[model samples]
Target: MFKSILVAVDGSEIGHRALEEALAVARVMDASVHAIHVVQTGTYPTLILSELEPPDIAQQALLDALDREANEFLADAEREAAAAGIRMTVYKRWGHPGAEITALAQELGADLTVVGSHGRGRLDRFFLGSVSSYVVDHATSTVMVVRG
Candidate 1:
């Protein structure tokens, strides 16, 4: 039985389902669920919002999208955890999703990791090459991929 479970949420319906599954498993095992969303760093803030330099239209748009994604991912995860009646810990990290997920699982001492195959935002399985796949390959703990 898993004592600590790490669930990756990305504001996608698929991610919600994965969290639901993780919560159920956590409840049965009395495990603590750690929910996380990773923001791929260096992909945002292309146009500096500074007084010296005006924001570039295209870069500003990308930044806006990335910012929204960060917010939405955390908000959705928080709602899901609340509805599940589980006071789970949530993390919003900025970096490669796969690496962050694996690190969090290890850091939290999780026995299991759960994530969706696809998520919201610009990232798709084919385009992003699958974060779940990376997590499965890199994690020491048991990983379950819920197809979105």
Candidate 2:
């Protein structure tokens, strides 16, 4: 019954699995699939660079690299969706992955949001913060967390 399915992919193995799972669900429900890749702009590298004098060039370069990676991830998802004969839309955002994904889902009024978990240990999750966990807690729509 999901008409719009939003999937968050990070180019990891689990992200790929999440995409596949979302596509399968979309296929079954005849839903439109939307994929989002968020380039974390607040990472340690970027933050460290920002404190330097004349950080413009370095920051831009780092952002460019992240953009390229995001594109690659979205491209793969697009190809998969094409091969699956599913209507898919893709988005790239610069922010926290979980926040961006949930915002996009709300903006698109997605009925279901799919995300992948790295299956990190409790300590790791506590320190690093889990994107899937955040999405599940914040998204207003249905959430599907595919664990790796």
Candidate 3:
């Protein structure tokens, strides 16, 4: 039984579904919920926007945008959790989603971590990698991958 549940939210439909599932499980177990959003900054600092010819994309500005987006996602997650009658502590950080989620879950003593499967094809996963897959393989706590 999970006493504390952690959910990774990306603001995607699948991610929202996973959050809902986490809330349901938390309700059943009377567990606390921790909702987190990680803004993946990848190699943006060194990479250029090929689409933009000049590629003058200010790395700092781009990072700021990502942070803003993450904050919005976390805010929405908090609202959803509130509507579900579940009190959830929301966190937003900039880093690798998988690693950050796992580390935070462990730090919070979460017994279970919930994530959504992006349904990426093998080829796509090979090139882009999968955060859910990484979290599932690396997390120390029990991980539930919600697929739709």
Best by lDDT: 2
**lDDT of candidate 3 over 1-148, digit per residue (tens):** 8999999888777888999999999999999999998876563554334555643448656766777888888899999889989999998877677889999998999999999887223442465438888988999989999886
Arrange candidates by TM-score, highest first: which order? Answer: 2, 3, 1
Better of 1 and 3 by TM-score: 3
- Greater lDDT among 1 and 3 belongs to 3
Model 3: per-residue Cα lDDT at residue 102: 96
Local distance difference test, each candidate: 0.82, 0.84, 0.83
After best superposition, candidate 2 residue 134: deviation in angstroms? 0.7
Worst 10 residues of 3 by lDDT: 119-128
Whole-model lDDT, candidate 1? 0.82
For model 3, the superposed segments whose C-alpha errors exceed 4 Å read: 43-57, 119-129
How does residue 31 of candidate 3 score in lDDT? 99
* lDDT by residue for model 2 (31-86), tens: 99999988776554554553446658777787678789889989999999999998
Model 1 residue runs over 4 Å out of place are 42-65, 121-123
Candidate 1, clashing residue pairs?
none
Cα displacement (angstroms), candidate 1, residue 50, comes to 15
